[model samples]
Target: MVKLDNVDRGILHELQLDARNRTAQEIADKVDVSASTVRNRIAELEGDGVIEGYHPKIDYEKADLPLQIMFVCTAPPTERSEMVDQILDIRGVVDVRETLTGRRNLYVEAVGTSTTDTVRISDSMHAMGLSIESSEILRQRQVQPFNHFFFTDPYADGDDNGED
Candidate 1:
């Protein structure tokens, strides 16, 4: 496993907040490091697979495709990984998550312009032999960076970092 120091955690925290607009220099300033160091660290993180690709948060409704459906499905444990890969090739599918256990082990999210589009996506999943247990319309989703990534200096605030 990759061990992350405070500076590394700080870099990740700042990037998670806003990677699109935050430059290496800005992150370096937050982490109290040089700009070149931040750049090199980011590169190393990417190379080590610690930092995955940056994805933009899209507003599908604003784009005129308002329907976002979440499909809870089941697949054989052995086939789960392959099914996820194939499901990603389906049009309108935005996300897929695999759970560790239970009957509904696969969760797939798809966007569409209307019911017809969503139905088509459902049919495709069935063709792949996925037994869909439930499907729901997604209302909203909120995401934030992990709080532990934000290093709070105990001495800076004279609070012992919330220790008991």
Candidate 2:
């Protein structure tokens, strides 16, 4: 694990705000660092695994897959990895989150054109010997940005002085 300093946090903040099409030089200007420095820091972050790959935020409404279904699956501990791989192969399944402290060990999310397809994905998982529960996602409300201030606040000290 690598520790990130204030500058590193600032760089990450700028990238998250516009990483889809921002250049390192652009991020550098915002973070008050040289362009090469920004680029190198980003490289270091990626190398250290702090920064994962970047991806686009798709508008599922216009992408033909409007129905979102979330699922919870409980399966044999030994078969967990295989179960996730099989679930990923299902047509409507989009993403999966593995868990550590819950009754269910797997959380799966899928998007489809209709509820029937989503249900079919769940049924298929059942046939694979995994117990599954699923729900329809009516809407995706929000994805809030990271609190860059929490990491970059200069006045912050070991003790809380005034601001809350």
Off by over 4 Å in 2: 148-164
User: Per-residue lDDT tens digits of candidate 1, residues 1-164?
Assistant: 79988778878877887899989988887778999999999998898899989999999899998999999999999899888989999999999999987589999999999999989999999999999999999998788777575455522545432212
Give the alpha-carbon lDDT of every model. Answer: 0.87, 0.76
Against the hidden reference, what TM-scores do the models get? 0.90, 0.81
Candidate 1 — which residues are off by over 4 angstroms? 150-164
RMSD of each: 4.0, 4.9
lDDT of 2: 0.76
In Å, residue 123's CA in model 2 sits off its true spot by 2.0
Tell me the number of clashing residue pairs for each predicted model: 0, 0
Instruction: Give the least accurate 10-residue stretch of model 2, judged by summed lDDT.
Output: 155-164
